[model samples]
Target: MDKIHLTFSQKIIVNVFRQVRIIKGNLVHQKYFFILKHEMQLSEFKYMIHDLGPYSYDLSGDVEYLLQNDILQKYDGQISVGNNILDKVDDIDLEEDEIEKKIAHISSFIQQLFDRTLVSEKNIELAGSILILLWDQEIYVKSEIWEKIKKWKPGFFSLIEFDSVWDILYHKKLISKEVYIPNNYIERLKCLNSGSKNAREYYRLIEKFFRYIFKNELNNFVLKEYWCDGNKKIDFSAENVAKKGIFKKMSKYSSSPINTIPILCKNQDRELFGSDLVESYELLNYEFSNIAFLTIRSFEHDQWILDEMTRFYRENDKKSIKKILFLLQDIDLIDMVEFRLRGIEPSGILKEKLRSVITNRNVVPCS
Candidate 1:
């Protein structure tokens, strides 16, 4: 028989099924495995950042073509290589001189991950998520990178134990060796939050704020300029589910959990303490998030703000998710970035302030 014709994406998909029979394989699995092409630049398909990580219609279309034409097949929710797998893989062997070495390396790695029961949508997506940020030159710190990935896919990572999977990928070298070290963090923060003129940029930097300071504690969605029915502008907001972090402990022990965290960014340093309290408190919808976060540089060591924090806590009132104002500051924006860059968890800083807040004492300064 003559050689079979295949599209670039078709050959790449075939190569994956050839090496391993992926159980529960589907489009998500296919797209993530296809990220292999992105790593080695094997395919020409371009992907946009989807909520589920990178996605490409070109790749999706080619997958449909291959399956419809029987170049690839899926049976019993198990995806394996087809009988006529890519005319011996020559078309996607990448460079003939390289002689399929890249695919070979990938197949071996996938097989190893499969053997160790590490191949899954989340694990592969984790690696791909890291690659995406590295490519954008957004972050290089491991802990910080992990935080950002969790923020992107919170619902997925929330219930899974993925630390072991990450160690294998990073410590064992599946991540690219060419690493980027960020140098503009301090200056970046200064420029973004310096004046009301840059408040828009500061709103954008709020995502950076969560990844840096919160460090996987809160899974946030940036909603700059989000408007309410009452027409008040919400500078930012986040998923109120506290991960297995300081906030989690607060939820478990204190029962004062927030539904959605509303964060507001300001231009000049003001004693934001309680200024927005009655407004934010009145703003809470009974069916939705019941708490708020106001951005401040430092918790002004005032007895009134201290009193405002304690006033909201009702030991027996589970319905009282409101008035739990968690104040974040500017120093944390810089300090936590450095902390996570060195692969440190910024939870200690959080714990310090939270402890003081819950105890209704003067909050510890972020150092």
Candidate 2:
């Protein structure tokens, strides 16, 4: 069996099989396994894994999250399906037609799951949740598997010739239903009663809000205005998902609009804030276009930092690039782009000086 490097979606299936094999391979668990086996013997399964969830759920009361995501595969463990169905094969000495008949019987069971469960909209939502859970794993579902589930219904098979493919998946422990408790009235009530007034929290929330705006609202900006524009000066817009690495995987339901400027979302406090003017100058000087400085803290770039940034630009002779800082609360825009440059590694010192220039009250009365 080949080892499968599962995506988040595939992990659900792989983990189910891995867990079952672990249980089956355990000598101490044999008694419980037989109890499960005996029950499975009576079921009309075309393959074996359909019974594992109920067996484990009956014992543990908690469903495994991995099984629910379709992330598992045979390579996770050495497991097989059809032993129960095939046990009588030798006794019957099956002819070719007889073998085909048995195969069809098994295939039908597998077909039911694909047709009934996976392709349903409910399961797609489940898939989305799984992706969210696996967010840290950096697994993304592309359009191919997305469309596959969209077309599934109960009793539908991807291919008629394949016997027991779907059931085998279940029996071999590659996929299992993950039971989730839906939000109740209490959760709804709790959601309604929530509000945070902290200054830093407010800044973070505001920054988060723009992320949604840039993703959803800005997509059309690129398509209609930027793409068709005669200048073609806009190589790419701020809202492009591919360019905005983190936003690529955000939930489509999020209220972010794709903006014409690059947006970064940082969730941190205000007093511990870093210099934006400095960072922006470094980024822009490095020719990192379409950048947006977004943070959950107050946008207070210091005076030395701003001065250093402006001086650096003048020194480099690329003064055309503009600097504008927007305060999320009042939409206050400030341009503090003048000060002397002083630092070690030109970039690092440049950042420090730019912030100092922007935020410093004295300004050093530069001539």
Q: How many clashes (backbone N, Cα, C below 3 Å) per candidate? A: 0, 64
How well is each residue in 150-186 modelled by candidate 1, as lDDT tens digits? 7887767742354555456555565543332222444
Compute each candidate's TM-score over C-alphas.
Answer: 0.43, 0.22
Off by over 4 Å in 1: 1-4, 21-24, 31-35, 84-97, 114-120, 141-155, 159-162, 176-367
Tens digits of lDDT, candidate 2, 1-367 = 3332333222222222333433222211222232232333422211111211112332221122222322211223323221232232122222355433433443343334334544442332333223222222222222222233335333332332111333333353432321111111112222222222343333333333333333332343221113223432121124444443333322122333323344333333343233544544444434344234433233355444445544543443332333333222112100110010011111222244334534555434334
Give per-residue lDDT, candidate 1, residue 364: 40
- Compared with the true structure, all predictions reach lDDT values of 0.58, 0.30
